[model samples]
Target: MVDGAGSIGGELSPVLEVGKSLAAPIWRQFMYLYNYSTNFKRLEKEVKKLKNTRDEVQHKVIAAQRNVEEIKQNVKDWLTDVEKTITEAEQLIQEKANNPQCFKRLCINYKQNKKAFKLKREGIDPLLQKEKEFDQVSFPTIPQDIWLRSSEDYLAFESRTSMVKNVWDALNDENVYMIGVYGMAGLGKTTLVQEAGRKAEKDNLFEDIVFVEVTQNLDIEKVQTKIVEKLSIKFSNETERANKLYERLRSGKKILLILDNIWEDIDLKTIVIPSKMDRGGCKLMFTTRNLDILEKMGSTNNFQLGVLEEEESWNLFRKMAGDVIQTHELNSLPNDVCKECGGLPIIISTIAKALKNKSHPSDWKVALRELRAPSPTKFMGFLEKEYMKMAFKL
Candidate 1:
């Protein structure tokens, strides 16, 4: 740059001095070509390595896709197999439930091919391992004597030996005695049947006695479960519940089945009620406020459980009010209370117990007067208005 900017006095011209640079384009171009070639080769090598890695990854991805498909197919196949086994199990159970002999045969068959059946039935896919935890098998428990509004009716029936014997014979009869006990609420229809259950058990009339409550909210599955549980059948899944119940029940063992508190009409065929062969000498008993339910259950003989007769009413009342009688000074009040109880044991018993601690006739009179008033559990009005209506109509 200093040489190019020469002094004006004695220096060379600036334009002439600046034009003296070396012209070496040919050498620079050659060097550039050589470096480009090296860089191109290096890029080619890196591209080749990337291609190799991509090929490996693609192969792995293809193999993984195939494996996933294979797993899916295996699961589907296993599910198909399981469903088939469940269908067969259910059919077998239905057969056995209908006939006690089939139950015995199924037990034998199950023992023979337990492994094959399990694999065919449920354990085909390991993914469904948790499904085994879900249970359809419930063994029946010895139900406590928790009589709901039916105990008193049964108690009254116990006093009638002829009626008791009639019921007993009908239950023991071979032609599947379907006895219906019909009444209104608090009239003791349930009580009568429970009393019959106690008697049946006491008399050793059957190999087993089972009670199934068909509540107002009736589910056939629940009824089926109750029967199965009572019978103590071992079932592992929903598909097996019905079959297992049938197989366990088909032994031709004389059994008494109590169907209690039936609210609606249920189809016997749908519910798997035993026919002549499957019945195994089973007797079916039903109690309901709905006579329609009784008719549907095929009650050959229906017993209309009425309010306690006057004497029976007094018997129940005196039993409950003995404490009241002892404590109260006026003896006339006991008769007054009984007269007002109106021949309903439950109402009389409940009121008598309520009045047991009170001291005065005024309290007794008030209780009696209240019962006569428009209120729930109006003991006297129930006989004249409610019980008679239910007895004749229901």
Candidate 2:
């Protein structure tokens, strides 16, 4: 370039004029014969390497998806580019191969050579190293509780079976934005709600189903964090989490969010739960012990879970207490114990399981006496709901 420098495009430099005599031979030796022709071969070799590298990346993406992961955007873009480049290269190679090894072939190879060189320098070579960073191509996309289907441990009581159907139907109803499930403590409200979710999932009623646990005390950050974790992203704008969540949910339609064990009414939006959804759009299902709270939270359609009847209660009790209750010495005693449970499945389960290993009648009699107490001192505090004390009454 310095030798070719000139005075304002008027005259060539003196040094360039002196070297001009060698230009033709130099061009034929390097640019025409050695470089262009060899670039085509070089391009072919590099293109094969590119395809092999691309196949490796494609395998990673497929494996990641099978593991329930979301592929990164760049990885997808790279794969798309690989497909395009390979397709174009394949066509160019076929066209150039049809030409004879003459000037015509050189002309054809010229274009293919530049493309192949550009692809290696700008697209393939750099990308091969860059793509290595994407070996772990995806991330876990589903939330911990997205897998919250009903398990075998779920007591399939008559009332719960019917209520699960009812909840599922209400959520599917177009006008229902939120559905409420309320029952006394220990009525298995959480379990029934999960069963409803299980059914909805089986039927593909929603694109995504997430279960959130909201106890008597609300933790706004904890709630928001749970949602963020499900989305497989981070949002730490302590104050702006709700707004961010609102936008995300608005854009991502058809999500079913189940909030379990709510003690009081809460503004769903405050936790980033969208207030508006399209027809057959996102819906909320919350479980609480209070229908009043559910109504306050805008759940006009509510399902009240009833306690198990005597027979259902007895059956559940027998299942938990096992064959020990069927022994001749303990058989009739189990009936009296079941009655004291007042058809409350949790209480029946608790009392029956407590007596499960007691082979002696004296131990069973002592357990029956404990069930009659104002507060079952041996059981957990949550097991002492007012109804529990009342049910223990003789």
Candidate 3:
């Protein structure tokens, strides 16, 4: 009889343990439900307030007079998280009110409710802080006199002047955004663009004009640094530099970004120029020696810079060569020397400067002969072709 009673007790022990486990969860659920019921009104009030705050933020984001695209996106993500938490809390409240019998279900609902409350508490402060930041943020002002101009005189011939004028007109046109100026090296592409920038500044066509030189061996960091310096914005962290640049430039202001000397196709976004030009009224004007690069950049207008005409080339040479060519005997010699330069302004300017101080006609003759020699690679190919032509003609 004692063994039978002991076996019966052992059999009941498992059942008792299960009952104990179930009782604890039941009690915990009861307490959790009581507390939740007591706080439900307050929680509802807080969530309502949070929702109203979110709505206000949304309205401010939409109605604000400045560009807040980055901040707005951040706010959007935060609100989405908050909304998910709110939905979870609502579902947990509904489950608890139904008095679920499963211990596991109650335990899960309780933990989830606690987590929801914690999330709401943790999220609200940052949301409010960001709201304050948004309130205080002042939109960026338009940049002025940001165009970099050379100290030397920009001589614009008839054709070159027409090109410059066309560029200026395109830059101002609301429809025309990107302008490309392409030509052989040393046809005065840089000088012509510089002149256009100066005129645009004087006319106030854009709020800001940023000039950066993107060379053949592109250094992205250097380009970003130059733009940062022009914008006068301080930042740390090289990894985030591109993002910072985008934020600064994305503000709603008409910006003219002049990228000089683009050799190949470069992703503008990598250099912090927004891939899409829709940010504010931002426009891009780049100079390249190849037309294909302009096409790659999606240029809306292209201007090919031609070499100076024979008469124009002589005039530029005489101006650069100064008083040496004014002598009666050297007059015809200067014209002959300018002819050999093949109307390339760089060669004409360089040779004219070399002959500036020399007075003798013999020196002029010697320089003309040197100009006709096969030039090194750095010299214009057109000059080489011209030399070959003259040699064949002779």
TM-score of each: 0.53, 0.61, 0.57
- lDDT to native, each model: 0.59, 0.70, 0.69
lDDT by residue (193-303, candidate 2, tens digit) is 787788787888887777878766799779878876665555667756666666666665677888888888997767767775432367888888888998888788898
Candidate 1 structure, TM-score to reference: 0.53
Best-first order by lDDT: 2, 3, 1
Model 1, span 1-394: residue lDDT tens = 2221232455644443443242556433333322332332333343344335434444544565554422234433544544554455445444434543333343333322333333322432342443343232122244444542234333543455566577777887777457887777666555567777877777778777888777777898888987877776778996688766665566678777888888787786556676645666677888888777777656767776666677777777777767667664756877777777676655675677676677777777776676667755454542344333333212
Compare the candidates by TM-score and give the number of the best one. 2
Give the TM-score comparing model 2 with the true structure, all chains together.
0.61
Q: Please, what are the lDDT tens digits per residue for candidate 3 over residues 162-211?
A: 77778888988877768999988767676678778887877888777888
- lDDT for model 2, please: 0.70
Clashing pairs in model 3? 143-207
